[model samples]
Target chain A: MNLDFSFFTLNIISNFIIKGLLFSIKLTLVTLVCGLIIGTMIAMMRLSKFKILNYPALGYVVLIRSLPFVMVILWVFILIPLVIGKSIGSENSAYITYIVFESAFYSEIMRSGIQSVKKEQMQAGYAVGLTYFQSMRYIILPQAFRNMLPVILTQTIVLFQDTSLVYAIGAYDLLKGFEIVSKNFNRPVEAYLIAAVVYFIICFSLSYGVKLTQRKVQIAK
Target chain B: MHYTFNWSFFFKSIGGKETYLTWLVTAWEWTLTISFFGFLVAFILGAIVGIFRTTNNKYLVTFGNIWTEIFRNIPLLVQIFLWYHVIPHFIPIINKAPRIVLVVMAIGLFTSSRVSENFKSGIQSLSIAQKHAGLALGLNTLQLYWYALLPQAIRIIIPTLTSEAMNIIKNSSVAFAISIAELTMFAMQAQEETARGIEIYLVVSVLYFISAFAVNLISQFIEHKIKIPNQTFVKQ
Candidate 1:
């Protein structure tokens, strides 16, 4: 079982792996931006005084959190065509699903972040003649965001890892790129080996960066 | 919203062998079995690895760190692929191993890394005074950990560990990639066959939600039962 990675030359890397890497990055970024925005809203809703707002947000988060992420991906893929009477490709479906699915997780993170910001901050904003929204926007959220940046970044790494699951939906993600190259070169084992290495390098470095930021945040405190 | 629902498809048997509901029940059992074994492996091994990292021994600490980083960094899906396809090639004896065994190992190994991280932190989060006090009393390292360290650490870590425990159950769904016919796998298959895509996915999602929620409730109950009464000391 002699391994031959000669097949993964520059040509294959440039064409297949690079393409998949780009999609993975794109999906991660889009999901991060959208998920965080929506997650913040959900977090706020959960924190809200209104029972109508709180219970539904609570239910959504609980429901999404309980199921497997892969099932969410698959459900979105199946549901889109059924509901719309036509199909958006798996990549688009994945975008929608990830934004929806990851919001639950991000919202939980955000809620903790918000809670960490003391009630005094909100009261102080009100004392300064600020409205509810003004207090949230100008006072509460910025501090919460600063505290939660590392946690959110960590979740982004998890999302990056999860983008690989789009392979199940037949999306041309980073793992899919490796699969294609492996098929072309007939080196299944080496492809998988390299793929794992690539994922490890990217995630481990990002996590290391997050650790640095966390330390910096600690020192700032 | 107007699509007709054919809910009875779950009651109809394929080729008079077993109903779709029964088939799904079997699939659910497989999912539970895989998750149970996978979590068992992760919890035990992760605890050991976590302990190794905190120990004074230099080599064990490095080895434990390497183990955690390698498994934690790579996605569980890719790890599953490696266990399913790649590892068997080098080890001929296991090439013929069953799919379920390989899938369990993949999920277990991947989750153990996460579990190990939590354990490391739980142990580290304790005050140095505890260790010093134990040493002062002439407690050996083993007794120190068993009495002074682990009991407290376990309580502190239960909330986080509960999530990891729930995670392995969800992680077990990646076995679908290898067609292990677990809940996720069977859900997709049932959708393709029955053409009642929404209903099938809904039922499966509900099943997953119930199970995952059950784990959370159980952990909460355990946490309540073992609460340290009259806690006056501040945890650092």
Candidate 2:
């Protein structure tokens, strides 16, 4: 029951833990870019005047948001082989599932951001002879992005924490790195405790930055 | 590549005792039980900490902030693993308790941080006028919160609370990591047994959606019923 720090040697960390941390960071960055792009598209669709565009986008967000991320990862891992006729490996599946799943949440944030932009702004764009898409791209989106940046950053911090779920499918994430090193050193408890502290410190510091930015954003408006 | 869709697997009997659907139903029952009790714990704990955050005492506010940060920052799966694997070795009483108890405790505490944040915002959204009114009536702090502040704040927060409730249900799936045999675990095992991964996961996804949707409906109903007339005047 003794807490042991000696289990975490420099050799084990550099060999095992660093690889997982790199993969986790890679996955988070990739998902953030892809999810935000797809989410912005979905948010635009949901806000469309045409019913043909909105309903399906609305349904996708609702359906995905309702299910657990772990379930989605498991579903993708099992179903991908059948769809593509070969296993894509857990790492690729983790990437695809997170991008798809996180898009739903990001879209919600984007939707609120887009809605917060004044209707008058779009009208003014039209008054100056700009197309709807052009107005959104040039005028509305920049302001909306400014308003929602803090929230988006906060959600990304959440996404970083969620990278731990990749372990459920045997994807090599930071948590998996700890698990392997712990097994090697026979100090599973200490390894997990250290992992928890690492996650906490990273998320806490990032969220503090988010809070500061949120206040500045509010002041700007 | 044509994958066979076994439509009858759900109703088909297993081991002459129960159908696959029955097993899924039982597993779903466990999911609901864990989420429901877990949310109850979160609501109570979150309410207390959230109130502490708004209190006059700086020490209590710091303590509440620390509780929220510690629980909120750690991923739920790691916390669940800690509770299941590490805590039992230290606290023999927890070791003696059933596995469900530990799972519930972990999930509950994990969710409490979000609930507290929502509660704090709800309280902060109220204006200084309400506080002045309560003090003008010569009410004590506890009485003021009980009769005047909380009722209105809870109403303002119903929408946020609904989403939190849904989140708790979705999060309970992580309980499967510790082998609690919840809906996610049931689906995983059933997929292995039947080789019908698509159908099994599809059904589980729908069940989760229905539970979350039901909470949404109930919350919307409560929100409609309790809405303040001319809310803008009171919003500040």
Candidate 3:
């Protein structure tokens, strides 16, 4: 088949591509913000001295980590409507699911970061008059967060890429937009190539940013 | 309306005493088969790429980086969709092959990047003295890798490999998106037919959990057994 590639067609597709990119950015950003907050809380709970605080957090991590992200997404989509008596739009539901799923993973990352902080720092903080929570807030957490920045960024990039899976759940993210465009034009190759380029651009830039930040962090240290 | 705890319903679905057994067995078979084949392909391809990435040759290293980045960044679901729907049209010769092959290939390619990274790091961690010793002993490149390097590398990599295996098992669920009738797909189908989504999903989760837990335990045991001795026995 001799295919005619036209400027007008390219222009039209570019608009859809931009929209898809915007949707992807929105999902990634919202999920990161929300997931990080929930993940930090869970991490704190997991790291708590009390068994009552730690065990439930441990169970949450194990259970969520064991199941596939797709299963969790489906469970939320299916169960939410049945149980809550309200329909969640595909886009919102995808964000919600990503937040929940990514939080479990990010919590582990945060817990490890917290654990990596030296015992001396905590001891010194106690040597001063500051309480445990105050010391964590003022000293230990700052160091841990600094150390964790590169890893957290890498995980964020991974989470951003993974947001594409929302396409499976009917969210109109970049990949889903490509699927729609490909079906419309019956040109899956062009559509997919375009999508791949966009994804590569995003991921590559994030990786480069991570490298740059790591160097900066090292120099500062 | 609250979901009543129907003990009989849950039991019948899980025990394989009812019609649900057919779906469960089929799903279990499909999931295991896909994961096994996919892991095999990924291991071979990943090992080659991993070794290539660690080579002194700059071009080969660039190729490895490009390959890993491309595969690792893209969502596996999109890759599967592209393989199933798009690739067949691009290569008319392969139109006769089953879609399952394409799905398997997609999974293998996507996973190879991760496995390759793990293997490359494992191999790179070997001491410079070990490579020198292999060279001094008049071993060829292949022999150096096979006899001197790989044994230790494999020992270091067992934990990572276990996690990768678990990843492949979980990822095989993407096969269901292409109508592969894997465990997840089977559960979805059964749920549709029976309107028992929660019960079927819980059972499916348990199935995945058991296999993943088994892999974890075996890897932990192997890792414990393989700890390097503190005393130096220099090959060089």
Highest DockQ: give the candidate number.
1
Point out where model 2 deviates above 4 Å: B11-16, B224-234
Q: Sort candidate 3 into its docking category.
A: medium
Off by over 4 Å in 3: A1-11, B5-18, B220-236
- Per-residue error (Å), model 1, residue A45: 1.2
lDDT of 1 by residue, A73-153 (tens): 988898788789899998899899999999999999999999999999999999999999999999999989989989999
lDDT of 1 by residue, B1-236 (tens): 47787899998887778988988999899999999999998998999899899999999999999999999899999999899768987997777889899998899889899889988898888888989999999999999989898888888899999999899888888999999988998998988898887898888888887778888899999999998997522255
Error of 2 at B132 (Å): 2.4
2 or 3: which has the higher DockQ?
A: 2
Which 10-residue span in candidate 2 chain B carries the lowest summed lDDT?
B227-236
**Greater-TM-score candidate between 2 and 3:** 2
Q: What TM-score, to 2 decimal places, does chain A of model 1 have?
A: 0.98
Error of 2 at A108 (Å): 1.5
Look at candidate 2 and tell me the lDDT of residue B125: 86
* Candidate 3 residue B109 C-alpha distance from true site, Å: 1.2
TM-score of 3: 0.92
Best by TM-score: 1
